[model samples]
Target: MAQHAVPSAAAPDARPATPVRVPVREILPWAIFAFVLAGVLLYFVGAEQGATSVFGGTWIHEFTHDGRHLLGFPCH
Candidate 1:
């Protein structure tokens, strides 16, 4: 008995996938916005009180109190 070769299921004429182009210019603004937003959030969580406070009174500090302690920031 002769052994027969198995044929591949994939088509030979299948086109190769093209690499997708990332629009840097379009994404840059949003990336920058996200970075700034993250920085602001970090500031609020880490240093939104004492001398580094941006807003007057204890409103911002109290609002983010739990977040501050959760993030390991010293609060007294």
Candidate 2:
């Protein structure tokens, strides 16, 4: 009678994952820029209209009409 060897149940490549460090100084400017950009977009999509209009005419309203309705801003 011949005996066969059984395989071991050891795990392979069990290394821990290291977290990357993000510095605030490097990301502050970009964050601020993005914030400002978002504010401007919000204004255009939500407010840019008559009485509170920055530029004259219905062009801005027409341009952002769908966006206004999409954002739940009443244009009509």
Candidate 3:
């Protein structure tokens, strides 16, 4: 009969786990970029129609038509 070896509770080579450090300085630029992008998207989806449109056409409104209704902007 062959005997199986069991692992010991106190392993010698195991190192302590450390929490991941997030570099805010590195992330700040991208965060600001994303914020600006979100603002532009919100403008297109909610208010890109009638008089306050950047592009002078109904195409932008039609493109984001369903999105307006979905986000409860009342663009009818």
**Tens-digit per-residue lDDT, 1-76, candidate 3:** 6643753457675567799999999999999999999999999999998878889879999999999998899897
Model 2, span 5-73: residue lDDT tens: 743345365456799999999999999999999999999889899788998888989999998888899
Q: Point out where model 2 deviates above 4 Å.
A: 1-15
Provide TM-scores for the models.
Answer: 0.73, 0.75, 0.82
lDDT value, residue 55 of candidate 1: 85
Q: Pick by TM-score: which candidate is best?
A: 3
lDDT of each: 0.86, 0.86, 0.88
lDDT of 1 by residue, 17-54 (tens): 79999899989999999999999899988888899887
Error of 1 at 31 (Å): 1.2
Where does candidate 3 stray beyond 4 Å?
A: 1-9
Root-mean-square deviation per candidate: 4.7, 5.8, 3.1
